[model samples]
Target: MFYFFSLDFSLVVGIFLFFLFIFFFFLFIYFFFFSKLVIMDWEIMSFNGFDIKFTFLFDWVSLSFVSIVLFISTSVIFFSFYYMMGDVFMFRFIFLVFLFVVSMLVVILVPNLIALLLGWDGLGLVSFCLVIYYQNFKSLVSGMITVLANRVGDVMILLSIGWMVSIGGWNYFFFDNFFCCFWVMFCVCLAGMTKSAQFPFCSWLPAAMAAPTPVSALVHSSTLVTAGVHLILRFWLFLSNYSVVVVFLFFVSSVTMFLSGFSALFETDLKKIIALSTLSQLSVMLFAISNGFCLFGLFHLYTHALFKALLFLCAGTIIHCFSHVQDFRSLGFCWSKIPFVMTFMNFSNLALCGFPFLGGFYSKDLVLESFFFSSWSIFFFLFLFFSTVFTVAYSVRLTLYSMFFMEKGFVVDNESDSEFFVVFPIFLLGLGSIFGGSFFFFLFFVDFSEFLLTSFFLKILIFSFFFWGSLLALWLVFMDFSFDKKVFINYFFYYGSSMWNLQFIFSQFFLNFPFFLSFYYLYKLDRGYLELFGGKGILFVFSWLGNFFHYISFKSVLYFFSFLFFFMIFMFI
Candidate 1:
């Protein structure tokens, strides 16, 4: 039933994504570990003072990041075989997935701003199409929100392109020596946030759970949302030259990390919680970019994608089996329903929490170690430290609340993976989530000096945050801690759950006002006022004048004039 088109085509494309992943991985290993480096450029336009070109700067950063994207996309496509096995429009969905991957590749490959927009806008457009694939009210609304939010980024990119004219061309790297164009880089960073779903643009990420799970796996995990961090990393050369932009980016990203992490704690819906987790991880990448560790950010991005995509897929597997039970409150004892899914879920959540030797461990540890040595402020360290703790807290809470307890709606089903298409892809990704970090760590960081350089206390403190956070979560959930009334009653929890009223401001206040204005103009001006004054009123005046002219014809006027003239002449005589 799924084969609207040739299944062979899907298999070929899926294999290709994996092939590209391996190809890039080998290339990255040679470049970073060995002596050979591959820096290829394709020029398209040459003009006054600058040329518009497509340049793939295949340093450790781009290659590694793109490898991660391709790897995750490959797995997502494989997972989709089971997820959409019987869907009528499976062909359309796969096509969109392929297109989305292509667009992301465009974003990843290009260094020029104008050329980059081709991919950037492509990601936005394709993501919108994918999000509304379900064609329901929720999907339509979510897709509209996604499009409008991404449009802000799309518009900013166009503005960035316009601003680049002052710098001679869209090739930002060419201006490395004369890096005074903060505004240009600033525009790019601003655009990045919208794509990355930072802060104000964040509501769309969770709302986009309305999309199919495979789309979520690709869109949230690696391709669409990561475009922002990828763009910022590409522009890091210019961004690092300006402290103001860095400060602004740092502030925004730190708050985003905290906010999303906090919000995940409040979220009950399984998919939405996973979506918020993606937001937090995206923020971490943004924060790393702001600190001028763009390469380090890229490393985290790579590792995060490995696990987060798997997490989404695992959630999809369970959601598929359960059908409608996405709420953790009612989804208790999932460990009983599918022990294997429970295993995948726990591993992913643990990876997300940066458990030792997992995919997240290597990158998260490096990023944290780097932060301590960077000599940033104590408050900065605190915010970051606590954000990590928040990650652990919520991850633990999610696991315990969903797995450890037995609720009224709990079901116990022992389903084997013999017929499940997800098993292979999930197992492959699970392997990546465990070993990809260590594997990439060799290609990523040459100097392990940073790891040993930090003080023992600082390292302990970092791990302590995770330990304490996890313990507190266990206490809160398992101890009958009255989490619902106590936390929900508090302002922070309430605010966090409501996503800090950001939805209210965006959806109700900002969005509604524009809609109100549009309605008023459509009804009051175009239909009513304009119809009366511009269309109907003008027609009425012309018709009345025509009638008046018709009543007094030209010949009748002449006869009346002649009679009046004769009468006047007789009177005068």
Candidate 2:
């Protein structure tokens, strides 16, 4: 008595086994920590032949990212305790925070595409929940759009998975197949571009600033966007195959970096500016990753997580202190009053601008070096260099205009003191931004004895140039560079006008396009064509003829013949 099973059964069993393994592992880890156990043993858990590993297998790459995610998340949670202390949705917020952490952990731990997709969609769901938690009309609207856009990426990921199965068979979704993987690689890369907010997909990130500052800190800086780059890094071997794809990725990243940096400079809203900067910095990491500098990209992601989260937390502190005023124009010199906040803010901004000796400087220089070595195209190098300059310029503008400079209309209420919880994370992140990269370098990559003796002159040159650029921006802002209003209007109109701008063009060219002939069918009132043949249109005629034949063939003859044959077989058996 043997039983035969279908492929579907095997699929179900495999999924169940994986699901149970993850569930029990999470439960065990939680209980171990909860029971105050100090287990020092490290080992890998295997399911079938695959290693379900834990420990310092969480190496340089994994540790760097995990630390950043957990640190930022912890900070956001701490800040939320203050930011939303008395709010009615405290329990809900905490739940979402935990959900986000769990999803991120799953994402980082899983080495298989199926597991990765589970975590990816789980994170998406959690983020959507966080976004719409307030349940306001604005949040609801933004949440819908954000989820919808993300779903497009999700579908792409699913298609990529299907392609993987079709091409490489079921066994090829793991780390071992990373090399020699092509179709799945391309689809996953496409999904990542959308998820990471590259170019056309970037509109949703800035719009997502509607969420609370703590949510912004966790979602924008530390976790969600970073996941996309993490995915690319996780499968670097696959991506390395298509050098053209890598170059295209670099180009998209460069465009996103410059555009978002410039947009940040022009933004009046504090959160929106930070949001745009997040997009720009993430693009920088993606560019680095695409150029075959996975470690450097991860390093930048780690450092940016710290500094950007601190920046947003500090911004949140200022916003809360000022009764929710977020405009730079309305914020004035508070260097003396909120000295701690200002210090942390300025430090983070300096890090963001890639100041020398800071963590950002090390990671950013590595990114630049990666680009420089990967190509001899001077135009590409120059584009990257100028983008860095613009990064410094906008960061300086943000710090100066908001914290140091005084505007006539700007005022601060005396009651705005930074809370310890909020200030603690800022201080921690500030320290990390100052020292984390060097510390990690020694611990993971090299000893001081093995460190290369590089040209200090180049470092000095780069630092001095950025410092000068920052000063130039400061001087320009102080000088109040003036333009005729008419000139500005002309420039705006000339460059910004597009098909997107013209309603008549959209109606005539897009709406009335003949390929959308079905749309006209909906509006047409004349049933002359239907009435001409008295409901016997082409489809109806075919349907009636088919039915008449079926009644004669199957119902009259075929049905009786099949029934008689089956009855005779049954009787004989």
Candidate 3:
């Protein structure tokens, strides 16, 4: 039943995606080649009194993004058949994924805040379901954190919706002076940051890895994380004018990139490392968008989705084969057994490192090179540079741990590449990892006139980080830097492993503290004072009143009979 259901769903969505991809690919070409701009908005419905409409926007950005999303989602659905083969609730899982895809599409296609929230809220609601699919305590906690953090964004969007009411309608594109609404822009940016797992809301991304690997591939790559970037991209015209917000966004995103990359270096869990990298790449996209590199940011968003999805899928296969062990330290030389999966894994790892000509290189190079000539400060430039360096270092570290080191852990000899469902989807994404960047580069960067001309050294500045980062990785891998000093090790672990204490500060302090207070209040107030004075006290008061009334009624009946008897004796006399 599961196989049949999965196959049918894949076939249907695949055909639909194929035609959509071709249509949009040509549509993009038509719009770009002819140097024409077109935005087609269709109103599905119109309410009477208030005059609100359900509208869909079809433009080059929406079309292209929809195509990419469809492609990735279809592939993920197909891949889930293999990854989730043994699950009893395969049907539910597949449908949830499909619903997630629909929600993402809704978010991508709708321009109006009202309609966009429909999709935005759907993404959050469905993600909560998918994250806690395992039904365990860890998954539940992760799901709560993920949903609560995103709820902050949802509230912002809701506030933006309410703010938009003053302007007659919720279509932000209709008004040119939307930037004048400072609170609205603030809400939009905050919503995007929370959705994208920015510096403040980043703990959820790593925590969300408790979800199924397939969910991670889809959510972290295309749908949920990128939704924020897409939101900011749509509102860039208004957001760009807010200089203070833009500078703050730049700072936040740069710090996010650095912190996430740095944390990935100390991360031992395979899935958490990849999750942190996703957070880092997301920061890159937001940084570009903040710095007015929306074109490069959009380009990078597309390419990063392809490679990151591939990386997660590859990681999924490895984890599945290795008894679900996600620690790289416990895994080594996996290529010796599952050579084919490992081969594709390397392709994704290299792509993530932004190797020349791969999918990531085109966007990463464009964003970095453009930044070099921009008027931004040198401090952020260093932060981003080191972040890029850390990216490569961690990529190399991941490779060494998984490919070069001796097989130090348990071996499952039953691993094989015979699963057609597994290899086929991976092969498709692998091809994208190899050529998706170049294809997207031509389509998107046809006219990079805004990129200032720079010297040769400046041209390869981003490329040079790869070399230095690799050297750092090599030193860290080969050197005996293990510390015997307990305090130093504690501090190192505290800073590195805890993401500069963001996990505790944000997760434990900000979120968990409030939750703890609630629990304490439940114990001290609801279970203590409120329980006595409120529920139990009311019950006791009612019970006492009932007894008092019964005794009064009995006394009244006896007195009435005595009075009647006395009246009857007087009448007889």
Q: Kindly list the per-residue Cα lDDT of model 1 for residues 222-303, writing each as its tens digit.
A: 8988888888877777788888889988988888898888888777788998999899999888887777676678878888
Task: Kindly indicate the candidate among 1 and 2 with the higher TM-score.
Answer: 1
Please report, as a residue range, the 10-residue window in candidate 2 with the lowest summed lDDT. 1-10
Q: Write the per-residue lDDT of candidate 3 for residues 154-236, one digit (tens) a residue.
A: 99999999888777778876656654477888889999999999988899899999889989999988899999999999888
- In model 3, which residue pairs have backbone atoms overlapping below 3 Å? none
Error of 3 at 349 (Å): 1.4
* Candidate 2 error regions (>4 Å): 1-60, 166-180, 407-418, 447-461, 475-573
Q: For residues 1-573, what per-residue lDDT tens digits would candidate 2 score against the true structure?
A: 011222233234324433543554454445433543222223357677765432212333554466567666666776776677557656667667767877887677555566567778988898889888888988976676577667777887787667666444332235354543666677778788878888767767876777888899888877888888887887777678787778778888988887776566556688988888898899999988887777778878888888888889889888887668888667777676677888888888888888777778778777775664575487776667767877887788777777667643434544445566666667777787788767655544554563334477655756665876687568546544445446664454333222123323422344345536765554452355545455547778889888976776676887667767888999999
* TM-score for all models, in order of appearance: 0.86, 0.73, 0.88
Which pairs of residues collide in candidate 2? none
Model 1: how far residue 84 lies from native, Å:
1.4
lDDT of 3 at 252: 93
Local error of candidate 1 at residue 86 (angstroms): 2.0
Off by over 4 Å in 1: 1-8, 34-54, 177-180, 407-416, 450-452, 475-492, 522-573
Can you give the lDDT of residue 151 in candidate 2? 78
Higher-ranked by lDDT: 2 or 3: 3
